[model samples]
Every structure is written in structure tokens, then in C-alpha cells.
Target: MMGLSYFWIDGGTYLGFIVCITLLMFILIMRSFDLKLRRKFTRVAMAMIIALAAGALELGLLAKGDTSTLIYAALLLKYILEGYMEIAVIRIVGRDYKKIQSKLLWIPFIVISILICTAPVNPSVFYFDSTLGLFVRGSLGYSIFIEAGFYLLVGLCICVKKWFTGYQRDALIILFMLAVVSTGVLLEEAYIFDNCTLTSSSIGVLFVYVYMYAERYNVDSVSMCYKRRCFYSDAAKYAKQEMAIISMDLNDLKYINDNYGHQAGDVALLTFAEVCRSVKTNKFILYRTGGDEFMILGIKSSQKEAENLISIIKEKLKETPYTCSFGLHMYKPGEDFEEAVVKADKAMYDDKHIYKSNKNKQANKRDDRFDEKVQSFSNDIDFFDEGE
Candidate 1:
């Protein structure tokens, strides 16, 4: 028969193993779905695995009737793993990929993992040995103290990262506080000073889970700028503001796409949108309502101010290789916003026609010049031939 410690087959051990397996499976399934989501959930799953393993080890020690040394080791391992996992999740989700790999931030954690796995005298295992009572006591005290020091160091690292990154937000602040509390409790446990207080890391874990769920599923699905739902909401609330709607469309966009390819068309649209962002003053909210069309909503000042703004935009376009046509309409207070938009769109179409006419006139003038040049060349050729 296998050497069975009293805690090895205990109910708690079985329960912990079951929980650990379930969490591991959950993480694997999440990874199968989407890469981004997998990256977000990996830390949570890893943390749960560590916690469950520690709990199972504790139960095993109890079953073996040698709980003292193993319990402290298991608990210390659990707390340290929990802190690392929590901070790792925050960093992964909050940072872009370049930031994650730049400073070799994962190195310390890898070293810690190797140490935990290969340490000859696992304080937890030492505590549970019946023949070494004094040895167990000393090891437990030393191990707990070391773990507490490590936790404090980890907390300091997190604080420094947050300071340089300027990530002093709600979730991070709560995490920093929890780390401090956990460090203090571990220190108390190490010194045998007093009854260790309950650290809030467990509760903070719950809060983080809730936050992740809400962030993943609860928000509107519109594109980043001027969401469709928000537009309706704001329209309802600010109906009394003297609104002006400007509608714009890129000129000869289809021609450009056909000649240069869709990639060039995309570049054109992005360039035009950037120009719009630059010209649209702080007072205006810009929306790309459809392909090749955009809308800007703002409080109407005077017609002269609006005209001046449009004139400045036109001057800027003269320097660019492509042009766009715009139509503007000022809304009277209590007027229908939809009606104003339609009027602006009509004005834009009219402007497009005007632009096309001017372009055609320029092209005709060029053609006439080419024809005159060809006639002059023919006359020169005839005169040279006659002289020869």
C-alpha cells in the first residue's frame, strides 16, 4: 500500500483536487475560444490552481496526523502565488504586449517557481513530520518570515510599476491595499506575535472577478468614437442646444479605389478622418456614420464663424492630394435633429456636383491645350520636311 498520510485521502483533499481540476478545465476552454480572452483569464486560472493545491496539501497533512509544518508551508505558498497571479492578471490586461516583454518582468516569478518546486525542505512537509517537533517549529517560523518578506517585495514592485505607468485607478488601488494587508498578516504569523488578521485578498479576488465579467459583456458594441447608443442618449438630453450638423463625403473615392486598389481607398478615408478630427473644434462631436460619409454635431455660433471654419478646412484640403465635399445646416432650438441631418446631406450632394463641374472644366481646359500643342508640332514637322 502507498504510504498514506492521515490527510492524503481526507474529504478536504478530495474537494480541493476537484476544484483545482475544474478551474484548470475552465481556463483551457476559455483559451480555445479567443486569444485575447484567454490572455485575460489565464492568471485567474493559475491562481485558483495554486490555491486548490495548497488546500489539498493541508488536508493531506491533517489526514496523515502531521499537520503543523505542512499547513504553514501550504498557506505561505498559497498567499504568495495568489499575490503574483493577481498582479500578473492586472498587468496582462492593462498593458500592451510590448510593455509585457520589455523589462523581462517574468524572470523573478520563474525563479520563485523553481525554488518552490525544488526546495529540499518544504516547510509544509517538515511541519507535518512527527519525529522532528523542534525542527518543524523553527522551519515554520523561518519559512513564514521569508514568505512575508517576499510578499512585501512583490507589493513594492507593484507600487513602482503603477507609479511609473500612472495607473492609479480603482482596481489597482484596491489590489495595492490587499497586498499590504497580506504582507502584514504573513509577518504576524511568522513572528508568532498575535493572531493573524484576515487579509482582504480573498474579497478583492471576488471583486476582480466581478469587474472582469462586467467589462467583457456589459458595454455597448458600437465603434470607439461616438457610439450609436450614446448618440441617442445625448440627443435626448441636449435637445435644446442650437445644433449644427455637417455631413461630408470623399470626392472620387470610387474612382480612386478602382484605379489604386481598396488599400489606397482605406488610406484616403483614414487621412480624411484625421483631417476632420483636426479641423473639428473641441465643441463638435464627430461620427463616421457610414462608409465614405461622416457627421459632425456642434452648438451653432454665428453663420460667419461656421463659414470661416469651413473656409479654413477648404484651404487645408487645397494642400492635400484628394478633396471631400461638405454640407452644413444649423438647427433652430426645438427643431428635429434628423431633419437637420437630411438637410446637411442634401447640401453635401449639391457641393459634390459643384466640385465635379469645376473638375470637368479644368480637365477640358487641359485637353484644349494638348490639342493646340499637337497642331503646332504637326506644322513644324511639315515645314522641316519641305525644307529638306
Candidate 2:
């Protein structure tokens, strides 16, 4: 007997629609995000908006007490859109899903869709009671909840995987959002509130958007690498474990800028970053700590492996016209991370000094050869004049 006003007054659906529409517009209009990320957010925002809109349609039809087929159609569309929302959430949060595992996720969705479609004929998933003017849950009515819960659980597993792989902060944020959605679902299932699930999902999406937007500050826009602020934060997380730190400084960044242009200097920095990314494994992270300074933090890497990585980087740089000075230090389990970084810094300076000394020696040798050639020519001219 609830009217359309009651549906709007509930506030959950209305608020959710506003949030979703805003997000969709932001995703479509924003130029800062990559295509892949824009696509992900777009899918999620569209799915949520559609799902909430379908819910509203179903509610409106139910309020009218119409025995027409439109109510059933509306209900079916709502259920299917809800399922898509679950799938879209999963896709947005995780990137490790394999092709086979991804295909398997669709199986449950297909089964739920089939069950929903059959409800009109077999009354398996849900049945409309014209006598009571109400829709009643059937034997398989709980399938949608189960399916949604399953997707949430899968998302949790992905978060845990990220946690163990050294992305603790990011994983924690995602887990918190999933927990919010989970609470909403539990509340709705308990009949304590209506539209709690969709509202919660919208709120979760908002949190993620805010968190991601804030994360932009942690990235260095020039080189597209993590900034100095994140380096200290991420390094502190490895205080209790053995870690490897590599300090790198470009050899002649100022020279490049003064001789060429600042734009050329930026190209050199980006080239270095691209090479580092190519040689870095999943266990390593790159951070640009200063204008010409960068650092590599490695998890569970040995000294030999670190040295080999340096060699690989040097070899890669040979393909270009630039070079970098490097220093490697292994941080023991009980040692201070800052002290290890200091040692790495000292080593990098010593290496830089050696590079400069070698360059000067080669320049002196070239100068001596030029002087000898000039002296020999002068002697030849003098001897020819005396003979004449």
C-alpha cells in the first residue's frame, strides 16, 4: 500500500540514484583517468544506476496493485540488474582473475537468470500472489543473495591476495568498502530496512572514488611513478622484514636541461623510469624520490639478485644515450630502514664520484693526444723551413 512518495521518502533509493548519476557523469567527463579505469568505473556506475532504476520501477508497479504482466517484467529486470551489479563490483576490485575463472563466474549468473525467467511458468524463484496482491519468495528465492555473497567473498579473496603481495594499504581500503556493502546486504536480508543493499553499494563506490582521487597525490605526474611521500610510507611497512633498497640518480640531468631543454630532461627521466619498469619484477617497486633521484624497494630480494638487477638496468641503458649511478644495500631484519637508506645513499655518492673520476681521466687522455699531434706538426714545419 506504499505510494511513490513513500519510495522517495525512504531516501536510500533516491540518494543512491543521485550518487550513481554523479559518478557516471564524472567518469564520462573526466580526462585524467586512463581508458581502462574509465571503462571499469563506467560499467559499475551504469550497472548500479540501472539496478536502482529497475528497483524503483518494480516498487512503482507494486504500489499501483496492477495484476498486469509489467510488474513481473520489472521484477525480473531488477533481479538481473542486481546480479550484474555484483559482477561489476567484482571486476572493478580485482585484476587477477584468469580467463577460465572469469568464465566460471558467469555460470552462476546464467543459472540465476534462467531461474528468474522460469519463475512465471514454474514459480521456482518467485511467485506473484494475485490473491494477496503480493510477491512471495519461492524455494529458490535466496539464490540471488547467495550469488551476491559469493561475488563479495571472491572480492575479499582478491584483497587478501593483494595484502600478501605488499599492497597492504590498498587492500585494506578495498576490504573496508566490501564490508560496507556486506553490512547492507545483511540488513536487507533481515527485513530491518529496505533498499539498504543498493544504498550501501552506492556509498561504497563513493568511498572508493574518494580514496582513488586522493591517491593521485601520491603519484609523480612527470615520470608517472610513485612520489617521494609514498616511498617513506611503503618502506616503513617493511621494517620487520628483510628488504633491498637501490638508490639511483641520473648522471647529468642538469646538463641535459641546460644544454638541451627542460623538456629533453623530462624525456631522460621518463626513459629511465620506463627502463626500470621493464626490468622490475612484481616483488619490486619504483619511486621517484627527487627531481633526478629514484629508489627501488624490493621484497624478499637477495644481494646477488639486487646486483644482477643493477647490471640488467645498466645493460638496458646502453641502448640509450643516458646513464645512471646506482647503490644497493640489503636491510637486515633488525636494522633501521632509514639507516639502510643512508648507507645506500653513501654508496650511490661513492659510485658517482668514481664515474666522474673515470670521465675526467678519459677527457685528460683525449687532451694529451691532441697536444701530441699539434707538437709533431709544429716540428715537421720547423724542420722543413730549416732545410729550405
Candidate 3:
């Protein structure tokens, strides 16, 4: 029994060492990429360091046959540090932390903290003593349940955030952390049940280290909407089906930014995007290609059908303050995708030039009205002075 307990303690400490070393290496490698360290990196490193120290202390307590208050404190410290690190990462990633969905993430941390608090006070009730009579503290049910719940939260955050925005590399790292913690909890349960001769937590921690190394050294690729990569990967698969591509560019966007502030320019862009989304006819994929340029692809019947859809979009924009120039193109059999895109782009540019010309003409008319007013006021003042 003593030998087995020693083995578990040693295994946990080894796992902690592996996790810490990997994290340190990961930090060094991340510096090579963006090197910003941001706030997320600092918190993550601190949390892992504390966890490693706690694991060492846990082994010490096991060897002494007395679980000291300091060891318990260290364990709680590790949990709190890890939880805060996750929250920090979420903030640094600029996710919608105020949303209701984020509350799900806190639930596991809260439950786990409560369980760990109760474990020392009610060890016999919470934990099961092994056949060898070792007091393997902490409830397997709560541990596994909380770990799995956290994993789900992290995974959902990663997948959903990536789907909406292209920034997902940090989220992927969070997912890796979730996997490591989950595997540790599961292995601990297996060890408690005597189903496993060795705890696999160390191996899991090692995997986490490898993932960190990969994240640090590897160039993280960003997902783009209209880029050739995503288009070929997704559009080609749907090439056999009818697809309508509508290309658009915001009218007078540069003029707006130059006349007004950039903030107003941003508002115009956001408003245009919202208007486009609201005018959705069917299942459509929207892409922002260049500055003030966007495209919407939908499954449609023919070129005329695509034009009708663009006409509807134009009507929707007419109701709004901003206007956009649009061009429609339907994917035809044997048509090169890039060439078709270029044709659509050229059409949109032609429309954009026409819109800009009309806008300039209107501005000239307004200038003429202002000049007429100024001349009439000056003539009236001169006549009044002569009469005096």
C-alpha cells in the first residue's frame, strides 16, 4: 500500500514537472512568433508554475502520511490560478465575455472549488479508500463531471468563436488545456478503481507540453473568407450545385473617411454589413475581401436570377443611408473560378465609379447653393452700407 501511494505521488510530481518544463519552452517559442506576451501568456505561465509547485507539495504530504493545511492551500491556489488564467486568456482574445453563454464556463470552476473545500472536511464521505487503505481524496464523480463540463465549455468557446471570427489559435491552446485537465481527472478515477496499474496523468501532461511547443514554433494560419484557399476548399466541393456570387464595394467610403472621422467611416462599414445580413435571401456566405468591399455567395438558378437577387439587395441599401455598388455572377460549368471572380470584380468597380461620379455631382450642386447664399448676403450688406 505504501509503495503504491508513493508511486501515485511520484507520478503526479513527474507530470507536474513535465507540464512546467513544456510551458516554459512554449513561452520561449511564442516569443519568436508575435512575442507580444500579451497578458494571457503571463497568467498562463504563472498558473502552470503554481500548479507544478502544488504537485510537488502534494507528493511531500503523501510521504509524510499527513495532509498538511499548506498542501491543501497550495492545491486551492493552483486551481484559482488556473481559473484566472483561463479568464485572462478569454479577455485577451476579445471574446464576448458579457454574454450569457460565458456563464457556463464559471459553473465548473465554482463546483470544483466547492468540492475541493469540502474534501478535507469530509474526506471519508467525498473520497473512497482503496483496498490497500490509501486515502485517495477527492470525489471521482465531481472531478470527472466538472472536468468534462469545463472541456465542453472550452470546446464550445473555441468552435463558436472560430466560426464567427478567424482568430482561433489561442482558443485552440485553451482546448488543449481542457483536454489535459480532463485526461488527468479520468486517469485519477481509473487509478481509484484499480483498473489501471499506472496513472496516465503524466502522459497527458506530456502531451500538453508537446502541444505548447507546436503552438509556439508553428506559424499560426488565419482563416479568410473570400481567399482562394477557403474558396477552393469549400466552393469547389459545392461547384456541381448552382451558386450565385454577388460582389459589392461601398460607395464613397474613402471620401467619407477623409471628410468625416475614421469612427464615422467604421460606423458606415458596420451599418453596411448589418444591412447585407438583414437582406439575406437564402443560405448565403458573406466575405469581406478588401477595404469597403464585400461579397455574398448563394445557391441560385441562373445569371438572371443572380441579378434579381442583387436588385433586391440594392433596394434594401436604398432604404439605408449608405449605398454599395454590386455585380452578379453565376458559377457556370467549365468556368474558371478565379477568372469569374475577376469579371465580377471588374463589374463592381465599374458600378463603383459611376456611383462616385454621381456623389461628386451632388456635392458640386450643394457647393453652388452655398456660394449663391453667400453672394446674396454680401450684396444686401453692401446696399445697406450705401443707404446709411
Cα lDDT tens digits, model 2, 338-373, are 889999999999999998888788987844653353
Candidate 3: tens digits of C-alpha lDDT, residues 93-163: 33323342345656666766666666556763243233433445444435635554554575566555644
Query: Could you tell me the C-alpha RMSD of candidate 3 in Å?
Result: 12.2
lDDT-wise, the better of 1 and 2 is 2
Rank all candidate structures by their lDDT, best first, as comma-separated numbers: 2, 3, 1
Displacement of the residue 41 alpha carbon in candidate 3, Å: 3.1
Candidate 1 lDDT over 52-144, as tens digits, reads 566555555554555464566775576457546644544543342234433455555555554554333655433445554222433333443
lDDT winner, 1 or 3: 3
Q: Return the top candidate by TM-score.
A: 2
* Strongest candidate by lDDT: 2
- Could you arrange the candidates by TM-score from highest to lowest? 2, 3, 1
Q: Which parts of model 1 are misplaced by more than 4 Å?
A: 1-223, 227-230, 251-283, 299-323, 354-388
Model 2: how far residue 72 lies from native, Å:
1.6
**Full-model lDDT for every candidate:** 0.54, 0.75, 0.54
Off by over 4 Å in 3: 1-26, 29-37, 85-151, 154-184, 192-243, 263-286, 296-321, 357-388
TM agreement with the true structure for every prediction: 0.46, 0.64, 0.61
TM match of model 2 to true structure: 0.64
